[model samples]
Target: MKQYSFNFSFEVLEEFKKLLPVNRSKKILKKYLLNEYVLSESLNDLQEIISETVIQPYWMTEAEIIKLDRLIKQAKTKGYSINRSAIMRDVMNNLVDRYRNKPIQKSKQHRQTFKVPKGIKERLSLLIEDGELTYELSSFIMDGYVPSNDFPSMRNKDQEDLNFKTDIEVFDKMDEISSEYGFKKGGRAKIFRDALNQFEAWLESDPPKKAALKQELKYILTEYKNVENISIIKEEINKYLKE
Candidate 1:
């Protein structure tokens, strides 16, 4: 974070009044001038002392202000560099963090879905027959892809099926299934590849059934883990759709 210095004066006060209506302007101006009073000291040390005592006290009073002025004069006898605005802002930020209790909001998690377009599906089916598409690619496709109006439906299905699962779960399940079957490459990649192969076979047998099966696989994968593989799958799906 960077620190910023602002110079506020009577001219600035006039400019501020332009932003307010006639009735509200006077009240605002009065408050602004009163706040500005702490900034009137010439020496840095005096300014700092006045700011810490008067401005940083949470509630300003006449007796406090007088005491702050005395402290400011005392500090001037010594030597220190202090800016009124800096101290005031520091205190204000602290007060806000303590009393205001603002909390940062995190982004909501969403489930994965599938939506195959008529054109993309046709192209994919052609690729499958031609043998240009692999089980890996098909797996990626089954995971999720773009350039289809059916994506919303696929996503909804995925959510309903694998709502609470995280990415690690998917990875673990893939490993477990592959190991049980004595898969040569029993890793996340291989499990995903296996899943894709099964999905593509379903797609080839019944084009109409591909969508439903894809949604099922997506739900299954989600149960295993919240993998970001969907991004890669989506990219491939887009590339295929573009072709």
Candidate 2:
């Protein structure tokens, strides 16, 4: 989606479920927008759009701001370019995966030490990817360990390496993310790019400017194809989002 210079604000909330409930429906008229985005119509219109869309406390701390500032400068010296919001997007994704998958303890009784062969995390990741136990990463390890006899069955399954292109299933959730951020228009690349570029708006015409965006868009579509790529790109872009 093409961005504008318009600005707006919202009283945000936390948790994805509250902001975007499963059975929610948008009551705004599609025709209220020029490109059909009620947001692009006016600042007030944009505010109203978000009033129904966003419900999260969203802000940056001074430490986060400083960290990103340094990252952007470092990346420039190394001949790279990215923006802060992209960096935050990546950080959020990593936090999600890292906390969601890594074994953790709510209390002492929750700690279940498991002795298993390598690639166990990879194996249990299936259950998480399949949405069997998103809230139970520790259970995955516990179950595999408590039933020592089941370890063989879990590991011996004739399963291929999780295909980053398809097996790493975060891309399917991109739509939910895009819609929440109000980039519900345009192709996948546009949605991703616009969300990352949410903080900036500069009118760029002429072939050179167009060419640069085209190149960036191409790189985004091809390079960020999977969860692994997303992780890698986030690391690189963290440096760019700083300043």
Candidate 3:
């Protein structure tokens, strides 16, 4: 038996943890390494990789190692030489694409009718009459029109800007997490980590603590929008608990 290791970020690692809960890492890697098309694509991606900083061990059987060596030699002969890390990186990346949490489709923007302050409504009407604005008054306002320097100031010292109530839609917080944490596309890993953390806590905590964690998990299930396959992961968690 031979063992191989590859460095990957926390998110990449977590994605694999959830995606292959029951399958061995070697089995997955062997499948990718033996595939000519997948191996070539993974090697091609190495040219632009900045490299991940976390190293994790993966075991490989003797026969799997032999096949990987052959593939490496073949790729080198074709002038597509790549290191083990590069190949593993591409393998993990492909797995991420195949198993990453997909966004749940939500409704598009819908028009909501609301009354504007008399002063603001009058101001909008005047703008329409001046031929400076083209859209209907409600549409223009709802579209979040910003007053330009050429236009008169909509705000005065005594009057505040009018607030309009708009329909609240199911919004995915993963986008914000990605931006805030400097993750380009791995924010969905947070959901998996959080859910697992809550389950772990529930397992060890006192009654009061368990009660809090229970509520926290429920809140997480409700608050984190657009995560698919959550229930499948939950089933895996349940299986672990039963064991």
Candidate 4:
């Protein structure tokens, strides 16, 4: 986090040589000037190198070297040790080998395909039943809309005079109720289609949504059965009246 500035010279190099091994002194000195490590001793070494060396160095100027020294000191205080070039080379090679051996991830662009489940089939069947139930409820309401000759007691009277407005209202209310139940078209047809698509994905990937889709299927089936029973009862009544 701390910034630094410095001037490089032979006197700085002498100071750096005191702390670094003789074999590594020049290499470490070059790295120090490169801002590889910020050490107090390295800064002193830079001063020594700059003062003793008569020929001007071309890699970095005195001002740049001074900046490098400050950075080295800051990095040292933060407990960061500089890695030697040889060490970095080995580490990079190991990383490359590990990456080469690891498995590649599948592309999201690939098309996903899966088989339909039996539960989804059952859901489709339930959707059909629900559709029939909605139609039956609609018929009940429609019957109230017009008078029927089957009602022998009221045969001579106008069916409209029977005042079945409440029956019509009840049928309209049923539609509102079904709409709130997440049934598009007053039935589970849309839900069935969606669940089938999700189920197919679950079969392919066995993702977490699979359990949720299964639970949803159970709910739809139960609701469908209830509506289907009501529809059947209504059908029976309508049939008897026709006979």
| Winning candidate number (TM-score) | 3
lDDT of 4 by residue, 52-155 (tens): 22111122335545654455456556664432222222222333343344523321221212232235444433433322322222222322122221211223
Superposing all C-alpha atoms, what RMSD in Å does each candidate have to the true structure? Answer: 28.0, 21.4, 23.8, 36.7
lDDT of 2 by residue, 94-166 (tens): 3334444442332212221223334544534432233322222221121111111111222464433221121
TM-score of each: 0.20, 0.22, 0.36, 0.14
Question: Could you give the candidate ranking by TM-score, starting with the highest?
Answer: 3, 2, 1, 4
lDDT of 3 at 47: 51
Clashes of 3: 0
C-alpha RMSD in Å of predicted model 3 compared with the true structure: 23.8
Task: Supply the TM-score for candidate 2.
Answer: 0.22
Candidate achieving higher TM-score, 2 or 3: 3
Model-by-model lDDT, in order?
Answer: 0.37, 0.31, 0.44, 0.34
Q: Per the 3 Å backbone cut-off, how many clashing residue pairs does candidate 4 have?
A: 29
lDDT of 1 by residue, 20-119 (tens): 3322333332344345334334454334322111110122334434544454455556664444344333333333343334322222322333223234
Query: Over the stretch 106-206, how does candidate 3's per-residue lDDT look in tens digits?
Result: 23433323222235434443323322222112222222222221212223424323332211221133234335656554443333233223322322332
Residue 15 lDDT (model 1): 33
Compute the lDDT of residue 2 as modeled in candidate 4: 15
Alpha-carbon deviation at 14 in model 3, angstroms? 2.1
Worst 10 residues of 3 by lDDT: 132-141
The superposed Cα distance between candidate 3 and the true structure at residue 25, in angstroms, equals 4.4
Instruction: Record all residue pairs in model 3 with backbone atoms less than 3 Å apart, i.e. clashing.
Output: none
